[model samples]
Target: MENDQQQKLISELVFLIEKGNAHVSMEDAVAGLPANMRTVIPENLPYSIWQLIEHIRIAQKDILDFCVSEDHEKLAWPDDYWTEPVEHIDDQTWENALNEIKQERQRFFDLLQDEKTDLFSPIEWGDGQTILCEAMLIADHNAYHTAEIVVIRRMLGCWR
Candidate 1:
């Protein structure tokens, strides 16, 4: 790909992952949420805000590892991705998980920014996956969960 095109693609991907161009960013969706409300499961919903954030963290980290490491172990679907149902979380734990998500996401942005990282080449250890594919997966997955978080907030009468 041309250098200009590659740079443009990287910029767009970064925006897609971090800015949530089409919807609320993950951070914004969770911002101002009451500590008590974080663990409250809305009626008919299968998860709480805490669970959703943890799921985003785990899945983002897993995809980051897969993109950056050859020996990355695949996590079991639905089981390893979602956290154990939790009814409570301390401030420190909540902050830590949120920080981890930011850190993992920054790492992915770094990978995208690296001029030597080939976005379109198939990953050697995988069947036929590319960094581009993984990037889209991360963005799409996070956006979907972020929307769910917003919906839960609305259902709980907490959304502005």
Candidate 2:
């Protein structure tokens, strides 16, 4: 039987991952963004909204892979996680990124929802990190970057 603490932890983690209790959700952040605006770098900002989105997707996918894949090779920090600056991003590219994010987020959510998953057990390939740790890390990381995307949208006057 799951204890109260374990159940509460799982519940809170799922809520944070899916709904973004205090900050904007990923779906809210990306919704209604124009294709042309995705690649636009707002003044003084280093990364465009699309770049941040891609970075989040890449990083989340990497973490998910690390959690599941015994043979997963870690990518070089910052470089492999980010994309080169582009002049413009087409609708298809933007849609693809969003789709990938949605899929990966669902994957993580499923893991958390699995009754058999040992959230506290260390992953064999990870450095003594549990699934609970990875789930929280992804939630926190996504929330951080999702807020950045919202800020960029506000700067561009694109967020509605």
Candidate 3:
């Protein structure tokens, strides 16, 4: 559990991005709330609102795994198959989605002390010199779509 500056930066980046995701998670986790309002999409798209979450979640997991194991092939996603799909999920699907996202986010942060690797390994599709770069990328990815969902929710009168 070393508290180095680099680890702090990674943790902070993860926190910032996840905070953005959490802002919309309340509305995003609303099951079948509305196709546009809900974060998880129920169809085949590069990233549905939920898909974005899943994509971000899996991306973080995959990247961390890739960095530690050098199993970058584990990062190989199918053609046009980036986000994990969840169509016609049950009534409580929203809860599951929320839990999954939160768990993955926490798990990514938990690696701070245990995994001593430099956080700068380039993740798939990452432009930065380290995982911290992609950390922001994932956060920005969620932020972008979460904003989209927020707009949709507003249009649906679900805005606070």
Candidate 4:
């Protein structure tokens, strides 16, 4: 791809991941959540806001790792990706988790920004996935979970 085309593609991916043009951004979905409610699972819901938050962090990190690392081991389904609700989360820990998500997201953005990273080339490892595929996967996965957080908040009467 030409330099201009690559830069444009990277710009679009960044916006898709960060701007929440089609749904609530992860940050906005969790912002101002009551600490008391973070671990409260709504009726019929399998996970809490806290679990969803952590799941997003874990899954995003996994995909980012896959995109960049040839040695990345595949994570087990359900077990590796999902988390049980905790009894409580301190403010600092919660903030740290959120910051980890932010930092990992920035790392992915940096990968895209690098001129040498080929967005369309297939991975040489187990799959034929390309950086473009991985980028869209991250965006889609985060958006889906972020929407779930919003729905759970609304169910708990906590959403504004």
Candidate 5:
């Protein structure tokens, strides 16, 4: 049985993970970006907006899978997490990335909402990390990269 405080914490964390109170939500950050503009790398920016989106999707999926899967293999850092910058961004690929993020977000939300999930229990395979910690990490990481996407859009003069 969750106490009032535990329930409140769960609720707050879910809201933060999904809604982005202090920064732009992931949905808004990527919304309405034209396929032509998705691959444009702003001057001095290392990653195109498309690369950032794919990176976010990969990283988020890794964290979520780690939280749930007992036999999950970790992805190689920087390499597996990022895609090479491409000259063209296909509309189907862009939509799939967006859909992947939403699906992963929903999975994390479901885990948090599960009454039987022990938020404080450390994963045996991980280094003393709890579900609560992973949830916070996902929220923070997503918020940071989502903001980067927004900045890229602004730099391209596409964000409205």
Candidate 6:
């Protein structure tokens, strides 16, 4: 990535953040979720709703970083560093952190959409693939967890 592209992406991220594009899905997914249940974890379930949000946000951050970085940490075979580790998080802290992450995430996604960078360009974090190649990789992760959050709300009897 050239310094110019990085500069544009950085500015675009700020524009996206100013536009308030994040939280659209999160708000809708948790729309009817009981405020109380936002902190609850189901039996044997290691991931909470807030944890999932944090995880996805981490992926977004790393992906965005790789888009501009010259050196990104290489991941072992079949082990993507883009994914976040899930663990119990304090309810209050999770909620606060999640909101902040959402704000940043919107910027990251918008940066990607606006970059329109070369599909053949190598991803700094990946083995040896273009940024486009890596982007397609994250699409499923976001979609899958978006569905998971939707279902979680339903399971909690909070989905309307």
Best by TM-score: 1
Clashing pairs in 3: 39-49, 39-50, 40-50, 120-130
lDDT comparison, 1 vs 4, better candidate: 1
Flag clash pairs in model 1: none
Estimate candidate 6's alpha-carbon lDDT, on a 0 to 1 scale.
Answer: 0.59
lDDT of 5 by residue, 20-129 (tens): 78998888887888778989988998999889889888998999899999888789987999999899977887888889888998998898878878899898789999
Where is model 5 more than 4 Å wrong at Cα? Answer: none
RMSD of each: 0.8, 1.6, 5.4, 1.0, 1.3, 6.6
TM-score of 6: 0.61
Tell me the lDDT of candidate 5.
Answer: 0.89
Instruction: Tell me the TM-score of model 4.
Output: 0.96
lDDT of 6 by residue, 1-160 (tens): 6768766655544443333244335556655555567556666665567656766676756666677676755445334522334444555776676676666566555655664655566665566977555555555555566667877776777776
User: TM per model?
Assistant: 0.97, 0.92, 0.60, 0.96, 0.94, 0.61
Best of the two (3, 4) by lDDT: 4
On residues 1-160, what C-alpha lDDT tens digit does candidate 2 reach at each position? 4577778888899889878799979999989988789889988989999899999999999998888788887899879999988999888888898899889988887887787788988998777999999998999999999999999999999888
Cα misplacement distance, residue 20 of candidate 1 (Å): 1.5
Q: Which residue runs of candidate 1 sit more than 4 Å off their true CA positions? A: none
Ranking by lDDT: 1, 4, 5, 2, 6, 3
Give the candidates in order of TM-score, highest first.
Answer: 1, 4, 5, 2, 6, 3
Report lDDT (CA) for all predictions: 0.93, 0.88, 0.55, 0.90, 0.89, 0.59
Q: What is the lDDT of residue 28 in candidate 4?
A: 90
Who is ahead in lDDT, 2 or 3? 2
